[model samples]
Target: MTALGPEGHRKRLRERFLRSGLEGFHDHEVLELLLTFAIPRRDVKPAARALLERFQSLSAVLDATVQELTQVDGVGPHAALLLTLLPRLLERYHQDRWRTVTTLGSTRDAVRYLQGHLEAERKEIFCILALNSQNGLIAVERIQEGTVNRTAVFPRLVVEAALRHRATAVILAHNHPSGEPEPSAADRQLTRKLRRLLGDLDIAVHDHIILAGPRYYSFAERGEMD
Candidate 1:
């Protein structure tokens, strides 16, 4: 290929991506390719490098809020939106993929499914995986958010969510944005409370999984669910 300027460089990047899908690409190159879609007709290399330098990592750049992204030089609203959209898009993709799954019989199965749904969350999100008689997944519902503190309304919400799905069993789930898989005292209390409440309704609490990034804590694994 002949040497051209910025336009040629962008074209080469596109061609290389099509040929091999980011395997040999540098972090800045990946950002440059993504920025090209939002910022046409300009040399986006500097902008990409600047974003990486500011954010300190590729994942951090994608995870950054639009306001944070727009603070960087050469990053406009359009570019910022494009960058911020990637993680949500990925989350939706993973969610859609898991929605097709019919059964979640093991802790590993449940963990894999929930990680895709909750690992990206920046705050605590309490959710339930409603399951049918044969351990087939009915639906994953978000019951509460914020901290997992006990509230008078929390049990009612859990019951309502379980009843809403007609779930014979449920797997409780919540994310710990702090990236520690250990269950807090509140988490344990809530699990015990919910298990007892759901037991009266003839519903089983299969597990309570706390997600902290890639790590997780499982109440069932520790025999706490019993």
Candidate 2:
């Protein structure tokens, strides 16, 4: 009897994936399956395990920058590039999901929309979701990106963008990489400042959302917005 060749083994992995959809596979196995798309003639199990060891999780492995990924043993530039492509594609896909999101009728709706675009981010970033007079979405624009814990958000600039879009309402959002969605004192202060400043311009501050990891805090939901 002939032992299973490398091709036969890969074929089995592919068949299992097609039948069961990764439900029974380990993390390294998933990476190995993905590597088969780009790597043709090599055993990718070691490379997949090395990537997980260096990055800790499949998500982290995909989110890693090219330079960071290259530091892993058995990961060359080509493999690293393939791994990094998932995040970029996901980012674009999420952006398209919200590209025509015109009506944010509920706090949950706003939170889910924000999560689709922001949850995977590794750093702090601020954005404005501008709404028309009828609370229809006009656009979602990133205002700034900052250090891990803080972003320099200028309320005046945000107001300017809202005005440019002729927005009558705004949903403010920022992410906390600390994995706790609780709003910090600084976050609360900034929210109050923007509410007052934009209120003065006859624009409504509908909500301020603090997203940390998978959790989210909505000021409107908490009765923090008047």
Candidate 3:
């Protein structure tokens, strides 16, 4: 039998992954394994270590821009693109999983979905979860991409999105990149004004949710949706 080499080591890593997943794999090992797919026939250990050193964490590595990632040694455009694509791929996976949730039965359900959709966002993006007459999820539409204040999120766009989705009810949602779930004065004002504008069209604003990392603020839960 041939003695173990880099290829053998990679094979062993794959076998180990097939056996127990990433349960005990170090961060660098995970990066090494991933880089193998992008950069074949190479010892990816140094590249993995370089990535960890440059980005500081596995999450940060996955979140890095292509330009930022390519700045690291041994990370070319293909590797950088693969790393940057991971987050969006994971989001698509979650959105597929979310399709199983036909109805958001409670505020918690809506919050959970919104958190998955918006929590990792670096910039503020306003979205609306359109609900059918029976509270079933019709669609999740991104209305605006920018700061989620009154000036940034116009009523006409929100109305257009809601009407386009044919939503009887909607749950307004946005993310706070600062990781503070507390609603700003502008947030409050926008919610009130939109509630009225949407109400005029006989559309109900069920809740306004602000996702801040792992935390969230719910206007409905806080008795502010009235």
| Candidates by lDDT, descending order | 1, 3, 2
Where is model 2 poorest over a 10-residue stretch in terms of lDDT? 1-10
Q: Write the per-residue lDDT of candidate 2 for residues 1-226, one digit (tens) a residue.
A: 5337657667878999999899999999988888877778688888899989988988789879989988877678888888888776776787777777778899888887887778778889999999988889888899989988889998888989988988899999999877788998888999999988889989999999989866889999899997
Clash count of each predicted structure: 0, 1, 0
Which order, best to worst by TM-score?
2, 1, 3
**How do the predictions measure up, each by TM-score?**
0.82, 0.89, 0.80
Query: Which residue runs does candidate 2 get wrong by more than 4 Å?
Result: 1-5
Native-referenced Cα lDDT, model 2: 0.86
Name the best candidate (by lDDT): 1
Question: Which tens-of-lDDT digit does each residue in 151-212 have in candidate 3?
Answer: 27888989999999999999999887767889989899999999999999999999999887
Per-model CA lDDT versus the true structure = 0.89, 0.86, 0.87
Best by TM-score: 2
Q: Kindly list the per-residue Cα lDDT of model 1 for residues 55-75, writing each as its tens digit.
A: 888878987899999999999
Clashing pairs in 2: 102-137
Q: In model 2, how large is the Cα lDDT of residue 222? A: 93
Whichever of 2 and 3 has more lDDT, that candidate is: 3
